[model samples]
Target: MIYRRFGRTEQRISVFSLGSMRLVNVPPAQAQATVEAAVAAGINHIETAQAYGHAESLLGEILQTLPVPRQQLILTTKLTPQPQDQLRESLQGSLTRLRVDYLDQLAFHGINLPEHLQWVLQEGLPVLRQAQKEGWVGHIGFSTHGSLDLILEAIQTGSFDFVNLHYHFFQQRNRSALEAAAQQDMGVFIISPADKGGMLYHPPQRLQEVCQPFSPLEFAYRFLLADPRIHTLSLGITQPQELQTAWAALRDPEGGWGNVLRQVQQRLQEREQEHLGTTRCAQCYACLPCPEGIHIPEVLRLRNLALAHDMTEFGQYRYNMFGQAGHWFPGVTADCCTECGDCLPRCPEQLQIPDLLRETHQLLHRSPIRRLWE
Candidate 1:
């Protein structure tokens, strides 16, 4: 496994981290085998959270049977911000489930809003500080799916030792946040690079063709690994086969991957140019600050992806997520566009903003799926 310096934490973390969310519902025996395979493959970091159902408990059972010493493992778990009085009890429950006395890292999980950040500062920080003093917590950090502005706000507070957020090839929205975290010398862990990163696990035929020798999933992994700012990428695994795939991807050297990446990227651009012509949204954010609180740019990007790359399913899934995502994604969908023409003068591409919004609404809106968890 490839290792990188985890910024301020100063630990050599495996570029691939074992994410425990998917293990929550798996049979115990299978979960144990998956964990063993990951550890044997040299994955030193394991990340879980209270929100991931029974993941911590299953991991606790596996930890006891592992051949390696406990000190060699870097364990991280997170808690949502709550009243100060309840913080310790909640953390204790996680500790009990994990069968660990102390956590290498504890994060304020899902700090996706300015209000969430305020709650963490007002009620959660003091409790986490106390835990750090008591040796129950080694470091304090946060994980977010918030807007880039909110994420940068949290990073600028200088209160966190590390950050876990979304940053990948399909979604470069958080690129600036990653740079800001690196400047603070904070460890940057990407949340989900496979499932949420364009669902590369089941790639479309065109994407597979363009990516060439590399599988779509491996291309996504290598794309993120090419950037040094990212410390680790989460491999949310349920089966041992998934772990093996990730291990193989990480073990593949970076020598020729760069050239391959450039070729694939060039091919993607050429495809987009051919299909989308000159009227596609540049995603420059100038058409933002919509009067009706519509996420105009995001909606347009989804539309462009669908039109440019025939990624209709992927686009539809994300477009449907807008209203349901609440503060995490924020803003209504293109249906909220009122055609006031306010965004027209601001758009450098001069594409019909309101018209595009209407087109997006038509192409991407569909019956929403109930999220399994928040």
Candidate 2:
């Protein structure tokens, strides 16, 4: 596997790291085999979280049987920033679950709001600091699904050694945050570059045509890897076979891969121009702070994907996540957009914001049961 300098930590972390969230529901033997396969494939960095159900415990069991020493691997797990009294207990639980004496990295999980950040600074950081002092935590960082402004605020604090956020070809909203993290020399780990990064695992035919020669999933990985600012991309693997495509992408000769990346990007741009015409949303957040608390840009982007790329299924799935995702996705769906026109002037494209929102809602709104299942 390809490795990169993980900023100030200075570890040569694997560019393709294993994310344990998907392992929580898998059979124990399957989970163990998957972890073993990843380790054998040189994925030294493993990320998990206390919030991911039983992922930590399952990974802990597999790690015990690995041939490598515990110190030879980089292990990271997360916990939500909690009340001062509950912090150590939470940390101890994670340690016990992972069967580790210490964590290579411990993040304030899901710092997705201003209040979450405040809690981490006031109640959480102190506990993490004590854990660090005791050598139970090696580095402190945060994982976020917050707005770019909030993420930048968190990084600018200079309180972290690393960060995990979502950034991919389709979801470039966090591009500025990635740049800021690089400027701070903090390790930038991208979350969900595949599934949430446009559902490339089951790419629509149009996207496949645009990303010729490479599967949409491989293209997504290459797109992120091309940016030097990104250190690693999380692969939420449930089976060993999922690792092969990524390994193949990594095996490409550097120069050849660079050429392919450029070609794919050019093709994607051409496709966008052809399919979206002039009425497409640029994904600029200037139209934000929606008076109705609707996430205008995200909902419209989902609309564009459905209309432009004929990715209706993916678009519907994501659009329905609005209310369900809570703070992680934040904001109401397009159905909440009032005809207030407050966002119209802010939009550089001069698109009819409310009308488009209504159209999006009509196309992608799901029943309560369907949303829950998804």
Candidate 3:
């Protein structure tokens, strides 16, 4: 139950924040138990969003029953970027749904595209700032699933008191963004580390073996928390038992994980090198400007993990998200590669780009799972 100061907001948020998106998908009783379990585990920060399908409503019912007082918990919610005039109503709606008069934090949800950021600065911020002045909201921030450039641009704006974005062991692509947030003194909340972080919740045998002395989930948790830039990791819980299970694995009693983290990292690297050889994707993002708009590094990274560590489940899970996730995961799958040889010259490794793209498609492509919203 380690707590970190969430940057400029100065709120001490727990290392793990309870996320409600998955809760809304489960039965109400389970959801209530899960929220109670999270609070019992000392998770003070609870985040929900307007787009999360009655999650706020359920929390409204559950919060009234919790033993803890309302003022003691740090409650947060988000709404999409709205027009200036509609922003107050949107904020009030979330308040009504949560049965709360004020929020500890309010975020402009899903600023994943450049246009979304533009709208937030031009139309949304004024209303949100007013809300803050009016005491309906405390701190202002945003959540993003956009490119590195877009994230960097948003951080440079210096308007946010915190940020909720993706950064984990498997996806260190956003490492620079994490550093930038630290520079701005902004709160850094990591979203979906166990699930989107290579589906470590049900990790492959190779990953399990490589992360010796710690489960994949445990290693992922430790690895992120080791970095002081990260303030909290969002845990999506649908049931009470899920929270218990995860926290049980994450608790380190002896407290000598630094040495273990180093050892396991070496093993993971060696495993990648053993199977991937020299053609392994460096993840440099140098092989960009693919005329076909394929996200080359991500595709090949997934391919490397699947081929090297038997992480086919994780690979397929993300590969299938190609077009369905919209701006959240914006890029076509490698099956759309046109063999133009455009990215080849840009790649420092000079690996067989088109051939690898075809291989990625063959190895990981599958029927798209229904989108989370669906």
lDDT of each: 0.86, 0.86, 0.88
What range of 10 consecutive residues in model 1 has the weakest lDDT sum?
248-257
Q: Which candidate, 1 or 3, would have the higher lDDT against the true structure?
A: 3
The residue-by-residue lDDT of candidate 1 on 202-254, one tens digit each, is 77888888877777788788888888898899998888788655765665456
Candidate 2 CA-lDDT value: 0.86
Q: In model 1, where do residues sit more than 4 Å from their true spots?
A: none
> On residues 156-246, what C-alpha lDDT tens digit does candidate 2 reach at each position?
9999999998888888988889878988999989998888888788888888887888888898888888888988999988899999878
Model 2's TM-score against the true structure: 0.96
**Arranged by TM-score, best first:** 3, 2, 1
Spell out the clash pairs found in candidate 2. none
For model 3, the superposed segments whose C-alpha errors exceed 4 Å read 245-250, 253-256
**Candidate 1, clashing residue pairs?**
none
Model 2: worst 10 consecutive residues (lDDT sum): 365-374
